[model samples]
Target chain A: MSYCVNCGVELEQSLGQCPLCNTPVINPREAVCNKSPFPEEKGQVEVVKRKDMSILLTTVMVSTSIVCGLLNVLVYSSRPWSLAVIGACILLWVILIPIAIYTRLSVYTSVLLDGLGTVIYLYMLTFLSESSQWFWGIGMPIAVLVTLVTEFLVVCFQMLPRSFLTNTLYSFTSLAALNIGMEILIDRYLQGTVQLGWSTIVLTVCIIVNITIITLLSRKRLRNAVRKRLHF
Target chain B: MAKREKPIPRKDWYQLDLSAIVYPTLHRHDFAPVYRQSVLLTEVVDPELLQRAVDLTMPRFPTYKVAMRKGLFWRYLEPNDRPGPFVQPDIKNPCQPMYFKGNNRYLIRFYYYRNRISLEAHHSLGDGTGCMCVLQTVTAVYLRLKGYPVETAFSKEQGYFVMNIDKQPDPEELEDAYMKYANAKFCPPRPGEKTYRIRGTKESFYTLNIIDGIMSTSAVLAVAKGYHATITEYLNAVLLYALLKKQESDRRLRLKPVKVAMPVNLRRFFPSKTLRNFITMIYPGVDPRLGEYTFEEIVTQVHNDMRYHINEKFLRGDITTNAATKRHPLIRIVTLFIKDFVIKLFYTRVQDHNSSAGLTNMGALKVPESMKPYIVRFDIYMGQPFSSRTNCAIISYEDTLTINFASSIIEADVERYFFRKLVQDGIHVKIESNREMTLEV
Candidate 1:
């Protein structure tokens, strides 16, 4: 006989609270007594375990790296050519292990680990040849810059309220910065003088796109029109 | 020596009806086209008696006692050689995704929670009317097992809904009536626009929140009679209004069409007796962008819309198009791989794009008079829509018309507005839910 005071709809005697508004149902004349509509036991779909996939991946990568290392030492004793294959296996393992094994691994940690793995692989490649200067000057700086820019973009996407315009603005701005940073590092390594040629064109186009996006963000009607047209 | 019993003759396999061809192709791990129909009894259900009832009723439904198998050209239903699915304790989550490979290949699952006996069947098996037959029979058998003098017969004069378990399976019951009644000469094109969708925070994939608003059928029917509309039309108007109000609360212009898909039972219009998904959806909607409408105006629009679309000629044209497409040389010659890809693409992109929400009124269920004294009420609950946030189903037994809302989101605004609107219309509603809400002092 109890009714929700807020919704004004009578509730089942079995219900202690109103389902619509979550209001307490208390009738001083009647004691609340009846079984619920559903049972106490709840069932849920079983999530497929990723641990088996992680074990399989580890076995494959480890065996491939071992086979390549043994071939370089025993069969092809002339040079250590297997370093490249082993480095590739190591890089892939580092990137996929986090995704397959852990659910709570943050995007920031994954991107940083990928950067470190790439740097190590490049360093390993330098061992096959006598040119360590290219790896230090070009490979190290570019990989680190790409990873840092990606991490910054991920942070921006997470921290800010996301819409089509906001996400595009973040992307174009980061693209320009990454392009400029890469050119500077490449210029320093190749010619020892800072000269911007192709990056300026990219920077100009990015600036124009970013300005257009900013304009669209500021005007609701225009943003809605573009959304309707683009069907995003 | 023990006396030997006579073996019942049945078909080993059945073809997927015209309407059923798309459901299996559109099935996903997160989505399955499943709906539930349950009966509430006066006493707590005994699991042993319920299991015996299920075991007795499973063999009577030839079209339902089968499992899905992939054929070279199409997927077909073959009789499951294993035993019937065992009855299980009902869970808070009623209709989860169903897979055919497991659980003895049973397409239908039975659950008992206290006085409620629920039957969750895949849409591919049959429509609500078809499954209702199985549910009513199971309930009647359970009552008989519990020492009630419940009589069962499948006389067409009385009605085709009630089943006789001892009789042999009929070939006409297993026939695909869609192919039988499809007239290719009257094929009509059904073009649709992308309709507005209710946006909300997504809950976990496994969670389905069910809220039931139990009300008196006479009270609601009297109100509908006042409006010069049928119960389905009146309820649809109320649902659309509730959705419109929810959309307007966002303080945005209500430009998108607020439409609810109403599933019409083909048996009412045609003479077909088979129960293999003979239903079509009619979208009765209001174009809020056109202008503001009063509640009376919306009712008139929905009433006229439903009256205009629900006819034998129009529905025949619609089913004709589907049947023609299925029988086309290009469609039939292709292997199932290509057919499945096309069907999946069409279903995901175009099928549910025309409706804001869905409302299915199974219309007052008629229980046999002998078993009426022991039954409390009947309920029909639709599973979550693939695109819409919530969908509703209605069924009534005796004087109680239970409106069940199945939602995938965490919000209760839609259900609140809907019931409050009914209460405002002078209909008394009693609310209950599978979810237990907290009470603040």
Candidate 2:
């Protein structure tokens, strides 16, 4: 018998407040009790957790490292070849820790840590090999370039308004930059000068695709047509 | 000693119908295509009596009594053969996700709270019409159990409103009607353009916020007549208009077509007594990018567009296209895992994006005169869709038409706009909801 003062809509007897507006229904003539159309306990579906997967993966990594370390000590003590297996496990753990173990860690931090772990693993290889030159010259820079490119892609995807066109633009542009950057790092490390060879063709193709995407974004009719065609 | 009874020869397995084939792949832990129909009675419900009534009515709906099973190439339905879903106390969240492992392998759930007896059915089993029939039959049986004299006699001259409980289910009731009616050779191109979606803060736990607008059926019909449109057309127009206004108020400059998807019941067009999934969606809308529209223009556009697509010819195209796609050699040869992935992709990318919102009208409900006195009103609820922020279901009893908006978002702007439009048109709307209105975005 009461109407919402703000919405001007009639309120049901069981409701203590207006559903459209949050105005409290203070009808002096009527008293509301514990009657409602819906019950009190709202059921929620259980959220699937990655804790089990994390445990399983951790067990595998730890067990493999242990078995290899044991064999290296008892059987092959001279070479200490298990370090390579241990280093590989460390790199894998670094990549999977953010994905499976501590998922709350931000993507930028995860990528940076992964790059740092790879550089450290390369340094470990310096002990087994003859020279520590490649670790600093080529390996570190390439890993850093890849990590930065991935971080940039993630930031653009998260911040930008997402669509098929924008996602494609971000991906191809990043791929082109990463491809050319890897070539330059390799050339600089080996030939003492940067020379782009295979990456030039890839850069050219990426530019054409980027220009086509920009053109589609500027025009409305073409964008709609592309959307329709790409649908499912 | 009791005499041994004969075992009936019945189907224990069935392939999912054309419309239903998509639901199994698209369902998740939080979202499934579940439809609910609840009837409010004059007296509070008795659980024991309701349970017995459900048991009595199960033989009449054989298809609804099964569970989803994964086959090698596709998922199918097999007889659940378990007791439940046991009639239990109703929860605030109706039509939540249904899992085959739990729920006694039953795809349908029955709940009672206060004076309402609700039935939630997985869309893989049936549409609104199927759920409506189940609820009506269960209610009739429940009344009978409560010492009310409700008729259950079947007759050809006077067709029964509530299905006769004693009679065995007709084979036609369990039929996959799409296969019988679809002409695979006459497939039509898929219809739908990516439309404007209502944006808002989604509920974190995926609880469906329902608001029921109860109004006089005749009053709303009279208003629709004023616009020279049917009730469905008028309501679709109102929803689109609301979305348009919401977009303008939000100051969204780049506009898309504000379309409302209406799930047309196929039983009305075909002589099928199916209780399985048999419905197709039709989108009627206005392109705001074209210009601003008055209410009259929206109504006219919705009317013509709905009428144009709701015909037998147009609907058959949808059936045929679906049937043809399923029958393709590649689709049939793929393993179940591959099929699930492809269909899930299609459902999320194409199907969910095609409509901004949905409004399904279960139309008028009829009951035997003897049973009508005990019933107060009926409410139908479309489950919250995966992407659409809001969905509406309408059903009318004697005079009251209940428009239930099941929303997944935190804001009430769409429901507010819809009911306010009706109230402004001189149709009185009494608003009720499942929860307190506290959150705003």
Native A-B interface contacts kept, per candidate: 0.77, 0.61
What are the clashing pairs of model 2?
none
The chain B TM-scores of all candidates, as shown, are: 0.96, 0.96
lDDT of each: 0.86, 0.85
Q: Considering only chain B, what TM-score does candidate 1 achieve?
A: 0.96
Cα lDDT for residue A102, model 2?
93
> With candidate 1 superimposed using the best TM-score fit, by how many Å does residue B236's alpha carbon deviate from the native?
2.5
Q: Return the lDDT, model 2, position B33.
A: 82
On lDDT, the candidate that comes out on top is 1
Model 2, B270-347: lDDT tens per residue? 888888888988888899888879999999999899878989888988888888888899889999999889889888
**Model 1 per-residue lDDT tens digits across residues B1-441:** 123346667677889998788888877788788899989989999999999998988887888889999999999999886876789988888788887765677788999988999999989999999999989999988898899988886486687467888776666778899888888587788858777778876767777888999999999999999999988889999999988888787576546888888898988888877867899888999988888989899999999998889999888888898898888998898999999999888877877778888899999888888998988998888896786478999988789999999988777778888999999999999887877565543
DockQ for model 1? 0.41
